[model samples]
Target: MKLRTCPRLQPLKESIRFLTRKPAQFSDGSRICKRTFAGHTTAQQACDALVYNRHGHYDDVLQLEKVLLPPVGDEDLRIKMLAAPVNPADINMLQGTYAILPPFPAVGGNEGLGEVLEVGSKVCDAKPGDWVIPVDAGFGTWRMEVVCKATDVIPVAKDIPLLSAATLGVNPCTAYRMLKDFGNLKPGDTVIQNGANSAVGQAVIQIAAGMGLSTINIIRDRPNLKELKDKLKSLGASLVITEEALQKPEVTNLFKDIRRPKLALNCVGGHSAGNLLAHMEYGSTMVTYGGMAKKPVPVPAKALIFKDINVCGFWMTQWKRNNMHDLSEIKAMVAELAEMVRRGQLSVPTCTQVPFPDYKVALDATTRAYSSKHVLMME
Candidate 1:
């Protein structure tokens, strides 16, 4: 038998030849650095990051420092960060209050979006100009740039708003997984959640609505309670009630047109978490992902034994670690959410941009009662 050459394979061969060659200059005749990527790849000479050597409050622990970029190798990609969110988890980790702690003298951010500046030999999955997110936590995303294995970053759509892409990896992914892995939720099915105004909660409201599910949002009663309810309701909530209202006899009447919730999402543990478990349907599960109240979950064992009400906890960091090798599921979920964002059906949390030089202001904001989501943008 004679081997035959295929005509259609020529373009791929040519493209590979082009990418592998070392280009010294562009059409404009500008010299390229020997260390820089030979083609579309580019990068800065140095990087800056927020890191802490001691475990303490953000006010005392975090410090900004400039550092040299690590050398890139055959399996690495250079990433230039665009924006990263300062989440409750990041703050908890900073204070040593979180379940997973990084080694001492670690960087401060867990999630963000970045631009691929360059890829080393043997790297084909990601390339220059592609927008990507970190695949694991403790990536030290608070840094201005990174040089890591190509698999360390996952590509996302560059067209989505920067804020959406920057904040997508943690909150939205957590909401998607919890809403999916816990129960067999269906259209018009009721779902109750406390901390409904939280980033994940807001995500649940929109994603659930997109799936035809109804939500009863529980928020702390504030002076501007009605306004907050209106805002959340506009985001696809079926009903919004204050924490005080959760215990009211009339609250049940709101479910007249809907069935009692089979699932409850909890982020505010303590009395708030107990209220969620108390009001959910028998045999339902309450998933707790956060404890903003800084108190223990008050679960009544009587209900657990008789009503069969179960309580559980979730940490996006742990979930990522457990499923790090197989991220195809997360990629699919992200694409789905991206479509919602593209269609304007999903909205990012209200972010207050804090430039890198004003880091102190942003760090302090994380400890306050402010409603804005603090975002650190590279200078």
Candidate 2:
């Protein structure tokens, strides 16, 4: 495997050894930090990690290094990463454009699935062989293995598809919350969303369908539009129309048969957002979660004066951060979503699985428009 040079990391020509450090005590009176490699030297325990010392162009700053993980603490679990996806948010974080940025010399990924390899004596919440995922973003999941606080990760069922498990924490969670939090939606209620082909959008379609709600999904006009529409429809979207179709007179007729959408999910801003606003029911709520168009959402004066549309935004990261201390809500949501996965209501998106050693390929594919989601498989 090719390794990138990082000034902070020295080349390892042979196996290296180190002495165990003094144990540190925590609130539970558990002392940790003392560990033995079981005859394995420090170099033997070191694993590959994609790290960036400074934020900038990913290609310029990201490096693959042999990193020795810290010993599992009294309240920690050692995990072996199974799979992770290269997401737009990961790219944005690398560019220092995301809402949350890690410190310099940070690891590069935020979402992935891992298997518990070892658990601290005090970690009764998890055990070896349990599947787990990070409870929040910025856990640096791009490495082969990690030792993290037990409370920082949540256990998930292992029966779901690898792709679904790897992606469960972010997009699916975001979709689940938005549907439940806004519009006070009930079964048979209608919802509309732009960027209907995004990972989160697809999750919205499935989760909404499972909850007996209908979705009017809108995407940009593109080649192979029929194929894309057919795919989303198969995932339980009530209607799949292009952004242009949303503005046509036929759109008015289309809504006549179905209730006007009370909740509009806007991931694409600019005029695409205006079209959503144009169709929303009076006193409806429009939740903006992304700005793929990189343009501000345009709200018409008439819509405000006549329709009284309520506008708001949601960032899943912020929501997770706010509720990290009390995970009851998050745990319940994950359980519901997991049940949906077991029932096949939620399935993996169309994606290509690239081996961990070929992460560069996955990274490149993620930047291309209309490409399948690229996942990095640790196997």
Candidate 3:
């Protein structure tokens, strides 16, 4: 048998040797460096980053520092951050309230999109100009640039909307997993969720809609309630009701058009969660992923004894930890979600883009407006 060889194969092995060769050094051992791809110099670089020296109020502790980054090494990629979101979790992390906290003096963001400006030797999976996102949390993405091991990030298609790619790592993944994991869900199956206007909730609505499932979205009553309801409905929500409406007797009348929800996603907790449980079908599951209300979930005795409602909690960080060894499923989910974005099935939530240096404004906006999503753009 004869082995066929492709004529298009580049001399990668030789290039690897050249790329990975040690930097030249003088007699005294000081190194000589050269500028390479995308104007990256083979020397230590200084970049501006948002660092928190100690866990406390973000306003008090978070500082903008000129941090020195080491040169890219073999199997590493130098990423120029494009954008990162001012997620609630990032705030919580800075305040020492989140479940996972990085070491002191850590950078702020865990999710963002970056452009790989330079790749080190042996970095076959990613190359200059490819867009990438942190594969898991604690990536410290709130920086101008980063030198990270290729394994720490995953390449994503550059064709997706910039904001969509920037915010893709967490919220949409959470929504996608909860919808698929909790329910033996099928097209036309009904799912209900609280926090309907939340980033995750909006993602749930869109992903469920794409999967042919219907959503009974419940949000807290707001001043612009009508506008909010219309917005959710436009995102493919089968029904949009207020949390107060969930308690009203007339709410049941809406169920006449669709079956009771088989799955419930609880983000607000407390009364809002109770409302979701009250509307769930018998033997249905409710997955709690957030406690924005900072209140305990109340479960009625009848719900457990009569309805057999199964309650569980989902933490995206924990899920990633459990599946870190084999990320095929995670990768597949990301691919599907990206395709959805390309097809217009998934859209970036309402966002206020603030320049990276104006992170304070973005943080303040995020803390003040629960419904608004703020992103920090490097440019």
Clashes of each: 0, 0, 0
Which stretch of 10 consecutive residues in model 2 shows the poorest summed lDDT? 8-17
RMSD of 1: 10.8
After TM-score superposition, what is the CA distance of residue 152 in candidate 2 from its true location, in Å?
0.8
Supply the TM-score for candidate 1. Answer: 0.86
Superior by lDDT: candidate 1 or candidate 2: 2
For model 3, how does the per-residue alpha-carbon lDDT over 48-159 read when each residue is reduced to its tens digit? 7887656788789887766556667777788899999988888988877776665444678889999998899988877799999887676788888887777777777789
| Number of clashing residue pairs, candidate 1 | 0
**Model 1: per-residue Cα lDDT over 164-253, one tens digit each:** 999988888888888888867888788899889888989999988988989999988788888888899889999898889889888778
lDDT of 2 by residue, 1-379 (tens): 1221222221111111131222232111111122233334364255677876667777898877656666667777888999988998899888877766655456778899999998998988888999998877777888887777788788888888878888888899999999999999999899999988999999999999988998999998998999999999999999999998888887799877788999999998999999999999999999999998899998988888889999999988778767766788888888788889999899877779999888888888887887778888887
- What is the Cα-based lDDT of residue 300 in candidate 2? 84
On the 0 to 100 scale, the lDDT of residue 153 in model 1 is 69
Highest TM-score among the candidates is held by which one? Answer: 2
Give TM-scores for every candidate, taking all chains together and pairing residue i with residue i.
Answer: 0.86, 0.88, 0.87
Residue pairs with colliding backbones in model 1 are: none
